[model samples]
Target: MLVSVKELHQQTNLGDVHKEKPKKFDHLILGPAAGEGLPDRLQCQGIKALNKIHFGMSRNNSRSIDPVAFVTVFTIYNSTVESRPVDLVTVGNISYNKVKRSLAILNVFINFIQVNMPQSKVIILTDPASELPLQKDMVTIKPIQGEYSRDKLMLQRIRSYIAFLETRLEKLSQKQEQFTHFIFTDSDIAVIDDLGQIFIDYPNFDLALTFRNNKEQPLNSGFIAVRGTAEGIQRGKAFLQEVLKVYSSKFMKASRMLGDQLALAWVVRSNPNFNVRRFSRREAFLDKIGGASVLFLPCSSYNWTPPEGAGQFHGMPLDVKVVHFKGSRKRLMLESWNFFSSSSDLSDTLCLILKSGRTKYDF
Candidate 1:
């Protein structure tokens, strides 16, 4: 017999159940409540209970997703002045301020995930030299140490990401219960909203990417989602392999600093199998490449970045989710975090600021 998460929560009194060891409950399914998705708080608590217990996937065909079926991954490395690119550093004698800033942003990012998406598992791939105090059941840290260079940084990230996904896919093939949706994002980002909605809204997509308004570098490589099913994993892996090939080739020598983004754009545009075209009236692009469906969502909502010269605190679009703190904007993430953390009603505040053709606050 199958038991819904809501039913199990009521029967077991989930609020106090976590105080002690939870009894095993198998054949659990996360069912929708009142034609709406389960509340984030309840889903999180249900995931906690389910983690302590053994539960199999429900055979029922429902649109609702299992709260624990997400695995978010991030890569961070402490780059010294020696390994850093000349153009990326300051003029005077170098300091570890850049690395410090990265760590700070990463802290905020992880905290946001812990608060917003507690049900999801987090995987951090970082250098062995750097020490991070993360010992939560939902968070895992894997050390990836190697010689750091500007070119090698992107290479290491792609290689590590691909290897991790492949390993997880292998486990799934072995009939092991693992996460179904994989989210790979950069460390220099502040997740303001739950990212699981992407998978829910756009199901069956092998890979999802965020695209900017810029024509030069349209696709942002910072946020990527890969569906973890057998075919989805295969297609996503194929796309990443193509990106790796492009990044490793001399074709991207002109802008090695932006190699990842450039390679992504090149693959999407140059690949004959990829049909890169905008959808009708919608700010989304759906492409079919090698029998895999790829979705290109607007960065304004999925991966928002504050405008240049904006003040410390700015109002974002009502629908803005993940805020990417790219380049010097990394310093502003703390301010964003502070605003988000203190706001009592974030949606209402953002709704008030959303004017016609205005996505961000000028002040």
Candidate 2:
């Protein structure tokens, strides 16, 4: 029952859908479409807008993907127009600027992954009805009805994350034949290298999450690589459920504006015994976590965060692997996007920008 965007539009005829078949996209690191029965719930809440801008062009059109890939990457996208309502300050004559910025970032992020990680299949589970042509080895699924109320946007986001984990795990359980491991990341990510090793690196660990600023901020749930295991599967479900409990508690509600990070921190604290390991390139994590002698990754390249409490235009690091551009720094998002967009040398797009040869373009 897993169909491409065209199939869903033709069959359901849901909200403002384009009946015309989407042009095949040209992807960076090419692979075939995933034929496994991955369900996409097409609400079609916001496809009309995505089409007008031609947000993500047919970047991967020149390439083809192999369906029987071993690695799968999962990410989610829920916009204000499609998922919830937010009042963002926009400058100049641009309308829906935040939404536009998000779409732009997603385009770059997907292309980066495709260019770097050629062997992986990426599935973007979004509630918005988007028409970004499928990047080679990429599929967009409308997993479940996203929370639409603006009364409590933060709470709604928490609910969406909970449902996201539930649906993805269930679908992955059914389609076990298509993948060996899965990496879940946020849409704001701009990856700079091939992440094929991330899937198989820690076979015993159930989940491998990225972190930053060990002394100030303990962790970030932005990028999580989870091993699909039936035995400890229940624990994963329970962890998400517990996150809801913590997020909905009196303390959380009483706080000004609670976010997913707080809930993730709660999960990490509550499940210290769980087989969850940290991945970051910097030595700070090792220094903070009692210098665990185990061979840990310098994940700074992937989960790079800008310096906090700094003045505007703090700029990105020279060796940052993935510039996250966190939510609080929405203003910096467009800047980060611009820096990568015009820079002529994306690591994956051209074979000329090979990992060993390209000069590090720092912000």
Candidate 3:
């Protein structure tokens, strides 16, 4: 059966929210991405719990709820300063647009969990008053600081933001006196099926992160799970700082491209007790799975797969769990609409057109 991206998402569902007491330490926390319409399933408290597990200082010491089973979706946005967008859209604004589409994908994930995982909850962590429209299961908290650049300097800023949030969450932990785990997933991810197997199988690694082989390399930073530790948090902070130092100045001058993802790749590569897994195209694209609990995911259709394969990776029109329309490079151009319309339509007409040799799918 020819599966479109949206259909794959709808199919993966958990029977119902397990009434049998929720499991402990299966919570998720995601940095909220910019968007208006978000799905009820974007709840990834499980992913956030994984992040807390990897980055939080101590489970007992943290002021978070325990035995939480859910996902936390984090929004990782880059700045326009780092990437000089040739496309006329404002980099920040484009980020919001990208988040909108990504939110659609997250809804697909929510649907998957309802049918497949059933026991997971998804949550959002971000500014409470931001423009994005939020639904139930989403908690909006005030950021410690005001608006900051979403650029190369963004890594440092985000780390600080994370640290600040952790500190606040720690206070809450103290008040409630509960130990908890957290997982942080960016908005650009789609959960395909029951990925609980990964977390259940691998318990040694402090964190699990996804890596790409190269540009055609699968999803880099598509998903990561970190243990809450001083060392782990320190590593995340230090690595992000160093990466920002390089990219904020000379690195940008050299590559003229800002990749916070590369920084994450570096840290994961250098860390001990950190399991870095790379997902193959088949696993990444065809499988349609990713989350904070996922230690590794390949760059594929679900997260930031190029519309026509313009970036390093050339993806086939396989069933995509989520399509992350990365705003960094406006590869999907809207100008001359009809000319490119053939590429996006899910009908056989486009496929037939490509078959006729008028245009190749090898964009």
Best prediction by lDDT: 1
**Candidate with best TM-score:** 1
Model 3 — TM-score against the truth? 0.45
Q: Write the per-residue lDDT of candidate 1 for residues 278-353, one digit (tens) a residue.
A: 5212276678765568988877667765442111123343355766666545434554455456664444222212
Q: 217-297 in candidate 3: lDDT tens per residue?
A: 233443444444444333433433554554444344423233555554443444454433433233431111111222454
The candidate, 1 or 2, that scores higher on lDDT is 1
Give the range of the ten consecutive residues with the poorest summed lDDT in model 1.
354-363
Off by over 4 Å in 3: 1-116, 138-157, 168-180, 215-219, 228-257, 266-363
**Candidate 2 residue lDDT tens string, 1-363:** 113445534644655446765332211111122211222211111111101111111233213322212221222334335423343334223333345555555665666666545555566554454344445445444444555344354455445555655665676688845433455576666565444444334444445555544533345656655455543233445654665677677335533344556765655555445333342224423121111111233444456544331111222223344555554444344333343456544422111111111111111
Clashing pairs in 1: none
Q: State each model's CA lDDT, in order.
A: 0.58, 0.42, 0.35
- The global Cα lDDT (0 to 1) of model 1 is 0.58
